[model samples]
Target: MTIQRLEVSNPEFTPNNTQMVTVHSSHLKRRHDINFYNVNASGQNLPVIILLHGVYGNSWVWMNLGGIDKAYEKVKAELNIPEFILAMPSDGGRLDGSAYLPSLNAGNYEKWIVEDVIDACKQTLDSVTHNSHFYISGLSMGGYGALRLGAKYPNLFNGISAHSAITKLADMAHFVETPLSEYQCEHSSEADVMYWLKKNHHQLPKIRFDCGQDDVLYESNLQFEKQLKDAQIPYLFEQFSGGHEWAYWHLHVQKTVKFFADIEQSL
Candidate 1:
């Protein structure tokens, strides 16, 4: 893993005010090196939250959005919290273009986040250890990525929240009557997303799903909520006045941080 200092700014943070570090995933055998953002406290050790972004974005989206501090300013202040870090890794996929599924080009993003990226962060960052837990969340494509990661790596993440995410790729394929483009090659089969759910279903983490009423993905998200309900999964769900845009996501990001902070204290 490689680390470098980055100049970042937003409504809530500036370069000096927040420690912005770039993370490079070094899987020696792999062809590509993934990039991600690490927003951390100035000193001491604290629990970390692995903040996954959507398909079309890199790790810098969180810092670009408002910095982690701005999103969770009120909650952190009100709770008198200990230091925490946000791990944002570029999932090595197209930005705002591809869905974060295992594609022919991007390889298996699930493994990249669950193993490779986490491993790199643990090695590169002193505060991050193998046992350090994470609270994960995302918006749109990111939301889908978060859900997939949390469900797949229950032991790694304590909880997860999604804002306007694509909950089910299989459902979307069925909805559109088309297989995922990347999974459409002659010998390639569609990703068994449901199989992933069933196999790891027993290890599911605390889940949360929310979306804008006017978002195009609203119906898809609603179907996912039903699957959770039918499966007796415990989660928090909310609907707000907006669409699948940055405005809603910016506010929703705060809610995610609060959720993480709350869960960390309980542990």
Candidate 2:
């Protein structure tokens, strides 16, 4: 999709500090809209947070779910979080999602997240840049991407959080046609979260992930946590009473933002 400048007249939002913009992605061969928010745009020494969406969803999920306003209102007024910019991007993948992977066969979705998304943020907002403190979080599929990316590029982020994330590569078999082994091996170091984290242990970022007790991915999350514990990789995991729905993600996203805030304090 070609992205062009336009006015946002959608009555669905109240418009606090949010905006809709487009950034071109060479990897995806298209320009896509990004749901962006700059909390105190003129405020100095602010950090940046990137939120990824799950399957069958787009960046608007954050807004539609009301996490955006809550994060802005709470992070500033209530929580001790520092000033930060939040960006939500549509992963430009057809069907369900890209799983934030790059493949010659499946197109370059990883670059869309790691490269295009970052570049767009810096260019679109004056307060963000390569040197700004960075963090990532997502729901379900987005959660998988956030954790994978945190390990893949620890230097780019201070921390990473995931909710109801898919920890194994094979769990995505039903969404795409490619084999899990082949997909993970394409254009990246490793696909499996545990495998990638172990291989890049030295570059891992501050990590934490939690899943709903009744979610289908609960067992997968447990297995992933076990792997991390067995390997002695320090992280935080929590189980709350909910399912794999927006109600669960929306409530827990507040915790994720607070988690990032904690990491900021440590640094």
Candidate 3:
């Protein structure tokens, strides 16, 4: 879990308070992108919120497109929340998307996010230490990654929030052009979100997800919510008025920041 090489850009070139990071990942055997934002470098032991992007998107979408950095700053100031380090990473650069799952054909994209990305953040950001609480979040395909990964690795995340998430692996068909067969793995449960949620039901952290009423995945999200209830898992699900677009994500991401802040306060 070592970063072979690290490159950071000047803040002048990037969006507000965001620094682009490229780490040569041993897991992916290639360099991956992570857009990082930390306003207070001197702050110690700050919580980290890792934001994952959807298909055809890289790390910059969270800030450059959604203005998540600005939203984070606003939320922190308005809610009086502690400073948080925002680390947004790409989805392994697979064709259209990797769905953030380990595949027999593709490399270990799941480990790349859960292991390499976190390691890169810890190595590059002084405020993100091993003791720092981590919250996972994303939109669309990345939302599936956040929820699945958070459920699968409950020990690694303190809170989970997703917006307009693809609730199941089959939902990837709507977003990706890649054949579904390429995502096949030995363990069937590895590709299923409900399996992980049920397997780790007792250990899961506070979970929350929302979807736009007009979003393509809205029905699937409702079905997934039903599955969560059937499994007796506690979670929060909200429906808003929008579609599956950046405008929706940009407007609602503040809720995610505040959600994480509330979790931090409780802990």
Candidate 4:
């Protein structure tokens, strides 16, 4: 993939040891932003966590709205978790969201995140490398992207976690005004999470997901959990007492950080 342009800020000037990067992606044929966080600037060969944002949000929402950076620090210090480089990229800037899917109308947002975003992190951060383990996580629509992409490309990611995800493409209607017809792909099953999960069940990595009990998508999440069990696929499912809001995500993101850290420690 071609990187037409790249810009990174000095860590000293940015908060939470964060560095912002703008990458000109060949897949999207447009420039997109990635917000990176490396607690120890000089640390090398650290694992990477790619966080995805939901509808009506961009890369900055992970830190600015959800306070993931703060949660990362708290989790690392409290749990003695290993250092991880956090990479949060935009969902290709479609209307309210791109759904992080490869669409006929919109650009190839799936490739933008699965391929370009990872390459941008390696090119911009000294701590990330080809050998670094990658984990994927997201909230809402992003949760759908994380689960689908992570399962579809098991070799690229070591673990997956999603929060209040839209279990099916049709569920997108609950949040976006974009026509669900636009998300249609060549294969009908391409938009289904269970399709990927079952297709790669033998080699799928550690998977976990959760939803606030009061969240609109809670029932769907429960149905997904049952599907996983029926298919005999391994996964972790949790239900928390909250709603589909930033407060719920912010409070629980630390669990995702810890979850990744635990996987790293096991490895």
Number of the predicted model whose lDDT against the real structure is largest: 4
The lDDT, on a scale of 0 to 1, for candidate 1 is 0.63
Off by over 4 Å in 4: none
Candidate 1, residues 1-267: lDDT per residue as tens digits? 322322223525535434433333342224333333334455434567776665556767766764655666656777766556666767565434344455555455556667666665565566767667777777776677788767766777888888888776544443233345643422332343334455577887777779999988888877877877777667799888899777788777777877777787788
**Candidate 4 local lDDT, 6-42, one digit each (tens):** 8887778877577888988878888999998874556
What's model 4's overall lDDT?
A: 0.89
List TM-score per model, in order: 0.78, 0.88, 0.96, 0.97
> In angstroms, how far off is 249's CA in candidate 1?
0.8
- Candidate 3: count of backbone clashes, pairs at least 3 residues apart or interchain: 0
Tens-digit lDDT track of model 3 for 76-172: 6788887888899989998898889887776789998888888877887777789889999999999999999999999999999999999988899
Per TM-score, the best of the predicted structures is 4
Clash counts for the predictions, in order: 3, 0, 0, 0
lDDT of 3 at 6: 89
Ranking, lDDT, top scorer first:
4, 3, 2, 1
List per-prediction Cα lDDT, in the order shown. Answer: 0.63, 0.77, 0.88, 0.89
Question: lDDT (0-100) at residue 105 of candidate 1?
Answer: 53
